[model samples]
Target: MSIIVLPQAFAYPAAAVVSTFWLTAYQMINVSIARKAAKIVYPQMYAEKAQAEASKEAFKFNCAQRAHQNTLEWLPQIIASTLIVGLKYPIPAAALCGLWTASRFLYTFGYTSGGPGKRSLLGNTAINAIVQLGFILGGSTYTVYQLLA
Candidate 1:
């Protein structure tokens, strides 16, 4: 069996991955807190639409849960981009990953903030995440080209 060698720059991307994991945990904690405040019982993933419409607490909890759920949806791509692009372009990948994580944090906060127009509150935050993805994709493309060249 051949030993695989990874560059030291990989450390940065690895740390970014760890940060994303912690972010997930943090979002979970927010959901738990919101659930308690909203009296959302265990086994129910969300408040009913009518209940949420009638109760501010329920709306808050739903926002928090949605924020966490959205993060989970994007997580695989974040992890994959960080690691795959880091294989050949570690620093740039890590930078983009860090930005992506930060953007996600803001997006989650905006979603859970209980402000007007829940999603519209911080639409730019999503733009930031998308921009980071573009950069990560660029890095990934270069990495792939290098690997196959």
Candidate 2:
């Protein structure tokens, strides 16, 4: 078996991968928080959902759940594209990865806050996420096209 040695140039892509993992874990933290909040605000043994909906804390918990769900939905795509795009385009990958990480951080706060206070941070919520998605998807697509063509 030939041992393939990746050079220092691969560091950036590796960092991109690590960054995504960090984001995933970070998002999970928010999920855990929301779960705990749901239990606290709606402490019915089997009516977590129903009780959560009725509680005044519903808005905050719901936002947290939504943020977690949104992260879950997008995570697969981000990881896939980040891996592929990072290999061939590490600079852009790193930048987008950073943006993705930062956006999730802001999203966690904005989501949990659930009020006008969080609204002040413009790109803190979604704009960064969209930009990250665009770059990751666009880069992945372009890389595939280039390879196939």
Candidate 1: C-alpha lDDT: 0.81
Provide the overall lDDT of each model, using Cα atoms, as 2-decimal numbers.
Answer: 0.81, 0.66
Q: Candidate 1, after superposition: displacement of residue 7 in Å? A: 0.1
RMSD of candidate 2 to the true fold?
Answer: 3.9
Off by over 4 Å in 1: 115-126, 135-137
Give per-residue CA lDDT, model 1, range 38-128, as digits (tens). Answer: 8989999999999899999999999889888977987887788789888888887888888777777777777888743655445656666
**How many collisions per candidate?**
0, 0
Tens-place lDDT digits, model 2, residues 20-51: 67776876676566667656543432225666
TM-scores for the candidates? 0.88, 0.73
Kindly report which residue stretches of model 2 are placed more than 4 angstroms away from their true locations once superposed.
Answer: 1-7, 40-53, 115-120
Which candidate tops TM-score? 1
